[model samples]
Target: MSTLGMVDLQVNGFGGIDFNKDDLTAEELDHALTAMLATGVTRCLPTIITAHTECLRARLRALDSAICNSRLGPVMIDGIHIEGPFLSAKDGYAGCHPKDAMRLPSIENFDYLTEGLRTPIAMMTLAPEHDGSTQFIRELISRGTTVSLGHTRATRDQILQAIEAGATMSTHLGNGIAHMLEKNNNPLFAQLGEDRLIAGLIADGVHVPPYMLQSWIRAKQASRVALVTDATAAAAARPGTYTLGDVTIERGTDGIVREPGSPYLAGSGVTLDQCVRNIMNWHGYDLATTFCMARNTPLSVLGKSAIPSVGDIAECVFWQQHDAQWHVTGARIGNWQVHINS
Candidate 1:
């Protein structure tokens, strides 16, 4: 079945627009949203990565204004995902975020940005190894936000502690940290081994291979997996140089390619639609499973209250199969069908 709507839970930025950039006006976000919709993403969590506290606070405030005021043209702001500032300091697997400001566990810092949001935060990524990390997880859980593990070097026991403390998710499982203790003792295996926790996968083939995605889906069945763009300013932007936080990301033809000197993927350039495409084409997964990974699973991540509905600030898009490809047919906001293609 070709589903009509889709949801993307972890998108950092799009069309040269970063959620963490203070200069990224509402108009730029609108442009990004428009591009996302064209690719079949109806709802999304615009993620903000770990950086300077002031920069993080400013981004949160800007997003709050845009969502409350509806300042971004035709785009809908579903919520936000604060990726980090508190994570492991390890070089390779911790990814390409700024190292200086990164801390382990700081509840005071978590409260700073969450308190500033006008809309709810869909999720937050934190490492369990930091001091008071468990307490921070519980606090975030009580506030109705999903806590995800990421950019961490936590041991298996530590991950279990975080999960028990209310951290029931993982952010881009295989992309975060590269070096890990062998066997099932690291975050990747720890997250994959648990049936209760949900993990977001890139599914772009570049970030994760087909066999791994297949194995993950088979291991967790259909209910525990979700797709994330992890997109940067280069998501829909043409191949060129763009910025993520304070770093420079150069986009290439095969999608956003990281420099040779980089450790992990610099930042994702994949889109929600492309992720769906890969699951179907690369891994040969069924359409229903792809839709679930791209939509329903993420909805589950938002908890039960904020789930999609006809009268509750609904956002969705429709597509129908046309020959060998899927073509966008319609888009809606609440009850209004705002855009229609063919």
Candidate 2:
């Protein structure tokens, strides 16, 4: 059946190409986009998590150059998702992000990181409880950037304040936190209760359990939920060790990516299409509804429109389900049509 082309707003890497690197090349970026397209993702925002200031700058420059030089341009690489350097420095909550690189949120720092970059900074993931984060979130919203709260130890009140200050979403709502938290009060529950905020959930099954995923969807409602891969370079690659930012993570035979000898997840090794299938099987959602959560919800949060009802030139994907897996058979991305070999 045909579905609206998927949009991934928080992809770090795929097809063995890590976007969170200082040495990312234009060709490698093109190959990554190709890999994503082969899996039915028509557009995406490449996410860069916590890193050194200069490193982030260099990476942003490289991505901007790649987008400018790419044949796909905006159709493939729509924007950038800056995930950190402004997250919680607390243990467990920080995940695999380098603590030394973490910093308090500031508009000046954001400006320095994004300076001279043509690619739009579509979204940012930051801890709301950090000093100056409220103003920074407001400023980012004013400048047309979508701000998301994540990697945080913020209290319920703090989250509400961030939402009041213009934070519109939660980045990977259930991940990026410690193993233990108080049952009633936590970032996850706080975000789930906020009707004004949309939540991005990594439905790769490894990031969140099926029951928990179902609970999150029920709390946030299907319309307020968006599926994200939160994928790392190990995604679509063979099981082995991979690097994200400077941390070494092992993708075991079970397909779970995590820090060596630690239970902390590094990132997901699943594609967005697989995430869609997992969500469908876990939640018993139909193809159209699942596509809405995978595609339209994210576009809505970014202030973009959904697919046209009566357009021949619409971006779309042709896929079929077999053995509980969704496979892309063909796709029309922008003006281009891609056919996959069976």
Candidate 3:
């Protein structure tokens, strides 16, 4: 069967390359995208995580240059997903992101970070609990950016307010929250129950336990659930040390990416194909539903048209399904095509 090309809205890095690197190169970007293509991902938003304001801008400029100069980046990268600098700074909510860099959301800060960039910020993940986030989210929406809430401890009412202000998505739901929560009243339930918010889930099993997947998907509804890989350089690469921005992280043989000696997950090592397969195999889902969550739903969240047919676009993946197992037989992007195995 043929399906829309997999679209990952939150990819940090892949293979052995770091998208958050201060001096990202075109060759490195191509290597990462090529590795991603083998797994049937035809497009993605290269994510940039938390850093100091000035350093973050530098990273953005460097990444913008790599995308413009790289062979595959022009076709593979949809835009940038900025995930930080405006997140919950307290303990576990901060996760692997540096707490020192976290701050309240502001338009001036956004302009400073995104100034002079060739590539646009297609999406941003920020905490809505901040004082001015309601207005800030409105401003971001006016500029054509998709706003997603994450790393937050906002009350359900605050989340609703942000949604009212045009925030339409949640970044990596079921993760990036306080270590403990009120079982009856929490951000997780708020996002899961909100029909207007399309929640991004890292279906890598490590991010959210496998047993919880079915319930979370059910709570959010399949159509409003989109798959994402909050990947670091560890993704699609062998078990080893990799860089996540300025921090050095280790991908154990177990495939968990974390800052050295820290229990908090730095990012994910799972590819988008595995995410789809995991959902189908874990639950009784068919490929159609899972594929839509991975591709069409995410693209829709980014304000892009969904794939109505296999031939609707020049980029898509040809799949061979045998019971629960699925593999990419071939992938096409623009004029480029390649055959591959799982």
The lDDT values for all models are 0.76, 0.86, 0.90
The root-mean-square deviation over C-alpha atoms between each candidate and the true structure, in angstroms, is 2.5, 1.9, 1.8
| lDDT by residue for model 3 (69-130), tens | 99888888888999999999977688778899998898999999988888889999999999
Which lDDT tens digits does candidate 1 get at residues 141-220? 99888999988878888899999998877888887776546776777788888877898888878778888888987887
Question: Each model's TM-score?
Answer: 0.91, 0.95, 0.96
Task: Kindly give the stretch of ten consecutive residues in candidate 3 with the minimal lDDT sum.
Answer: 307-316
Q: Give one clash count per candidate, in the order shown.
A: 3, 0, 0
- Give the residue spans of candidate 1 off by over 4 A: 1-4, 71-75, 259-264, 305-310, 314-316, 335-342
Residue 135 in model 3: lDDT: 96
Cα deviation of 77, candidate 3, in Å: 1.6
Query: Which numbered prediction scores highest in TM-score against the true structure?
Result: 3
lDDT of 1 at 61: 80
* lDDT minimum window of 10 residues, candidate 1: 69-78
lDDT of 1: 0.76
Candidate with more favorable, higher TM-score: 2 or 3:
3
